[model samples]
Target: MAGKSGRTIANVPEKSLKKTLFCWEGMLVVLFILINVFCASISQSYQFENVLREMPKYLTEMFLLFPMAFILVLGEIDISVGATVCLSATMTCMASNKGLPFAAVILTALLVGTICGLVNGLILTNFQELPPMIVTLGTQIVFRGIAEIALGSGGSISLTNADGFRMIAGKVGIIPYVFFIVILMAVLFSVVLAKTTFGRSVYAIGSNRLAAYYSGIHVQTIRLIIYTVMGFMAGLAALFLTSVLYGANTTTGNGFEMDAIAMAVFGGISTSGGKGRLLGGIISGFTIICLRIGLGQINMNPQLILIILGILLILAVLLPNLSARLNVKKKA
Candidate 1:
């Protein structure tokens, strides 16, 4: 009787888990299809070839989305990512202009981003009491400020040697190189989060930090690692972004943090953490990209497009919480 009861109880939660994941992901898939259809209907230029060509620029944010999802799942936030991108791009352009080897120029961007991320991690982990938001917010300003000073009076730096960036920006038969890279990264990050011990530890920490620490998880170490990874990805974003713009400026990556958060939330990742999947985030990221491209094709005002995204983000956050509350009431 005891063995039978244990098996029945385990099956119940497993079934419930499957149902919940299916419902959310299913809804996202339906929504994704609808979005693409709508986009295609409204714009002739929304065809596959044009969409693929435009995707590389937008896909840069997906790189940030992966790490940002991890950070969000850790129940923390980092707003300094945009600034890190700006600084990294600035340094990358500067290094290239100085006639350094292409490899060294790439390293410079990644190195700067990693150092910025390390600084955020050190301050947050060591302080223990400081909120991640406030710490990252400060770093955001500091990073952008440094980039501004480096940029001098013009506030921009164009790449003198565009050959390398041009090569990277090349397409592979109507598909951008960055597209494949994004897909590869998506698979890697999804596997890590869904299949690894470290991934489970992240969930445990997000669910309850004190309990996770008591259970032997090195919570602070993991936090440090994630933050550093966030910085590294921001550097990578800068690299590809430079490939697109062929230059760097103060406003480079200005609104990236918000866009990343919006994509994650729209994909059903809880900002409160301990819930959600990277798969949802990837779908939502592409959904938003397609929507934005469609809107741009219609020659919509940029600010108006931002407003529309803001509204969608609010609905995404609110709808989930409302559904949870209603579910609780019904159970009562």
Candidate 2:
């Protein structure tokens, strides 16, 4: 009787989880509509069809940071992303502004970004009590503070002053330089998350760390890797943001982590982690940019958008679990 009771109890959570996943998947439907409306409302210059007129920087947001979404879906947060991004961008900017070649600056950005990610992974995996969100949040402040100290004040450095860097960031016919790289990233990670054993391990970790461990997954090690990947993405994001701004500031990426998290959650990646798709996240991120742009055109405050985002995230978390209960009831 005890064994039977245990099995039944375990099944309850599984049913609940499935229902929750269903709700998350359903969110994509809403995302599709929002994207269309936003595009239609915009002038033709910004429309998808006028691809040549506007450079799509938002693609960078999805490409570089989608891995972070994958990590979050597996139940982790790297709030220090804001800090890490700023640091990497600052590194890249400072290098070029000081007379280094553009290639060297780009290389330095990518390498430093990877190392930053490695650091996040190390800290999270090694220190059992250091919750990622809180630790990263603290680190975010520290990293940015360091940036302020380094720069010493508010000043912008123009990358156009460095012709090579500007050209690289500029354009190639209809494609922006960053857009091509982002496309490659999109294809690459889509495969990594969807078709690999590592992907399964991530889901296992997010869905049930205890089960994943018992099932022979190295939960601690994998968790670190996820955090590490997020760090690297943060770095990649920094590269473009700083270069585009032609300036580095301690506040270069303020609240960017919030936007990314909002995009991830709205796309069906649970705040609690586990069961998310890269394509969904991509759609969701684009959706968010559209939403914000649409709102701005209509003279809406950015803060209002954030409030709406918060409400959506809450609904996202609750609605699916509610459906699961309903599903279980019908079965019973």
Candidate 3:
């Protein structure tokens, strides 16, 4: 009757069914609504069309959130994702500037990202004793260094042919294409995590790696897949980002890894792993995006906005632990 993550399988369906309807996600919904109201009140331009216009840039980060949730659920992290995005975007811009077909340019970005991810996976799997953070941190520096070298003294590249990128960034009515893609990806990732055997395996490994392996789960394989997926998504993010920026620079994805992690953590996904859901992450992602857009409209200093987000991140991490401790004390 016990499940892979050491929870009771009998109650899983009931819990899953009500998961979005109650608890953390419900509070997030309320918070999201309040944020919109507050933002609208503070800025006259916080209208629907204006928000959507600002969204495509921010939505690029959401692409990272899905696979990041997967990695976090596996009790692992990838700080190199921002570098991966930078590298991918650099390659994409270079390819486009060289007069390559738009299709080839797109492929270059995705391929670079996948290769970076594969390298990370190979290193981590081959050197089992190496911590993921350390390994990814090393790769992060190397990847960004490569990007900087590629850009040389200029440290940036503009897309000579932006027609393709512009098309993808196009909006239908008030919403951009990236918004739809994010929603589609959100559904796909959410379903896989919530309903599939693979999802359960991730939780099992996070909950107890040795037990999951003993239970017949391919722990290393799962980790490899998740990391590679992380890279692929980073590439996808870079592609969209190119659409928005029409170029690539050494700093293209600076702090993007932190932003993705913060969004995931805020969405109720635990860094320690074995718990949380993508739905919560999705909701929290939007909440933060809306909050940021609102703050910007009111002419808040950029540094101040970052500080506010940092404070929220701290609260997000702390509140759960505090609540859990309170529950334990009450039980005693």
lDDT of each: 0.91, 0.72, 0.93
TM-score of 3: 0.94
As for TM-score, the candidate ahead, 2 or 3, is 3
Clash tally, candidates in order: 0, 3, 0
For candidate 1, lDDT tens digit of each residue in 141-209?
999999999988558999888998998899889999999999999999999998999999999898999
lDDT of 1: 0.91
| lDDT tens readout by residue for model 2, 1-332 | 24755653343434575565555454575666766676566644445535333335454466445777777867878777777777887888788778887788878877777777787778878896888887777777777777777777664445545576567677776667777777778778778888999888888888998899999999888877777777777777877766466667767777777777777877767778777787777766766666655555556787897898788778766877898999999999
lDDT of 3 by residue, 135-209 (tens): 999999999999999998447899888999999999888899999999999999999999999999999998999
Backbone clashes, candidate 1: 0
In model 3, pairs of residues that clash are none
Tell me the deviation in Å of residue 156 in model 3: 1.2
Deviation (Å) of 133 in candidate 2 = 1.4
Give stretches of model 3 more than 4 Å off: 1-22
